[model samples]
Target: MVRSEWTKVWTTPGTAWLLITMVVATAGVSVLAAAVTGCPDTGCTVDVAKVNLTGVQLGQAVVAILAVLVVGGEYSSGMIRTTFAAVPRRLTVLAAKALIVTGVVVVTAAIAVAAALIISARLLPLSLGNGTVLRAAGGSVLYLGLIGLLALGVATAVRDPAAAVGAVLGLLYVFPIFGLATTDPDFQRHLQQIGPMAAGLAVQATTGLDTLPISPWRGLAVLAAWAAAALLAGGLLVRLRDA
Candidate 1:
């Protein structure tokens, strides 16, 4: 069943393109970010990992689209019926899809994140491969993988490509907006601590941990919590709803 799901994903058109886009878009944008933000002097204070890895802000949207199309596209075309016919266990089907999507996104995001880290690290004079730098680099890859899982859950729940894509992007962005709009400092800090984007990106901070709303690994755990909740909800819905 898992292999069958994997084959279905690879056989689909635009799958390869989206994966390539995630890698290329991440690497290319990160290169530009590093170039423009490159330390021209010894006193610059940019968060080196965060600076180059900012491309993830763009790459994740592509990841969302890729994930949406994986299962949601099947529903839009009525192919899910065929899928259900082949695999009677709906949760297993979703689990397979989740694994395949995570695998692909992780591989592509790893390549993109590694290239971005190397290129961005070069732009700064700071020594690389510290624990913080390694965490930022490695966490960015895991972050993308989590984004893929979240998207899969949203798409499975929504079951419409357009709606699922929109919902995923909205989920990714909306809380950040809320976090920024309020005037109360305490509330604002709490908002950022919980917002998926704000908190998850904390792992990319290499220099300003003292000022961040949440700790790096803790923030990532927040995003992981969100992903787990999404997958659980999606899994239950897939089993309860008729294909």
Candidate 2:
């Protein structure tokens, strides 16, 4: 199952292009962010780690689209029926896709994050040896992987390319808008605590830990929970519904 899914993914030229776009988009934005922010004096307030990795906000959109297309593409091409005919167990198919998507996203995100870090480091004094910086870098990679899983689950559940892409992007980008629009501080904090994008990105914070609505690792966990829920819902729906 895994091998077959891997082949299917690689055979699509768009998949390769999307992965390349993810790397470029992530690194490009990070470089631009590093260029605009500076801390020449002591006691600088900037979270350099987060600033350099800022491109992730855009990179995630591409990741979500790639993940959605993984499953949604098959459905659109009428190949899902053939897939099901080959493999009677629907859940296994999903599991294989989840594994492949996670692997590819992690590897791609690692490359993108590394490029961002390296290039951004040239602009800012980034200490790769620092424990906090290391955590932020590693966490960013995992964050992207979990996001891929979240999108895949959503795509599987909806079984529509356009709708799946819209739903996933809305879930990631819309909540922050709601948080920013409201006047209530407590409401804003609550939204951040529950929102996948806000919470997940919290891992990038290198300073002012006390001010965040959720802790770094805990914030990533919130995103992981969201991904798990989405996958569970998708798995159930895929099994119950006809392809």
Candidate 3:
């Protein structure tokens, strides 16, 4: 099942394109972020990992879109029936897609993040000593992979390419929009604590940890919960629905 799904993913034209898009967009944005910004004050505190990895925000959208197309495209093309006919196990099919999607996203995202940080290594202040840099780098990679999983689950549930893509993007951005529009501090903090983008990105912070709305690892856990819930919902729907 895994091999078949893997073949299906690689044979898809957009899979390579989307993965390329993710890497280029991530590295490009990181380069731009590093190029445009600098130390403005003497007592400056900036999260180098977060700054260098700013491209992940853009990269994640590409990842989500890619994951969406992996499943949703099958529905759009009426190929899902064929897939299920061959596999005969709905959950297995979804699991294989999820795993393949994660594997691709993780590899490309890791490369993107690594190259971004390396290229911009000169631009950063570099005062974040000890394991902070390692944590930030590792966490950023994990965050992108999880984002892909979240997108996969969403795509599996929605089953339509356009609608599933829209839903995934909404999940990534809507809470942040509401958080920005609201004036209530408590509400804003709550949104940040739960919003996948706001919370998951916290893992990339190498500075100002005390001021974060949610602890770094805990914030990541929130995202994990979101992803798990999405996948579970999607699996249920897949099991119940007609192929």
lDDT of 2 by residue, 99-187 (tens): 99999999999999999999989887689889999999999999999999999999999999999999999999888999889999999
lDDT of 1 by residue, 114-232 (tens): 87777766765445668888888889999999999999998898899999999989988998788678888999899888988888989889987998999999999999998888889
- Highest lDDT against the true fold, candidate: 2
Q: Which regions in candidate 1 have their CA more than 4 angstroms from the true location?
A: none
User: What stretches of model 2 exceed 4 Å from their correct place?
Assistant: 41-43
lDDT of all the models against the reference?
0.87, 0.94, 0.86
TM-score comparison, 2 vs 3, better candidate: 2
Worst 10 residues of 3 by lDDT: 38-47
TM-score of each: 0.95, 0.98, 0.95
Residue 155 in candidate 2, Cα distance off native in Å: 0.2
Per residue, candidate 3 scores C-alpha lDDT tens digits across 1-243 of 999989999998878888888889998898788766754434435666778778888999998888888899899999999999998889999999889988888888889888878777666545344487778877888898998889889888999889988998898899999998999999999999999989998988878899999998999999999999999999999999998
Please give the lDDT score for candidate 3. 0.86
TM-score, structure 2 vs. true: 0.98
Question: Would you list the rank order by lDDT, best first?
Answer: 2, 1, 3
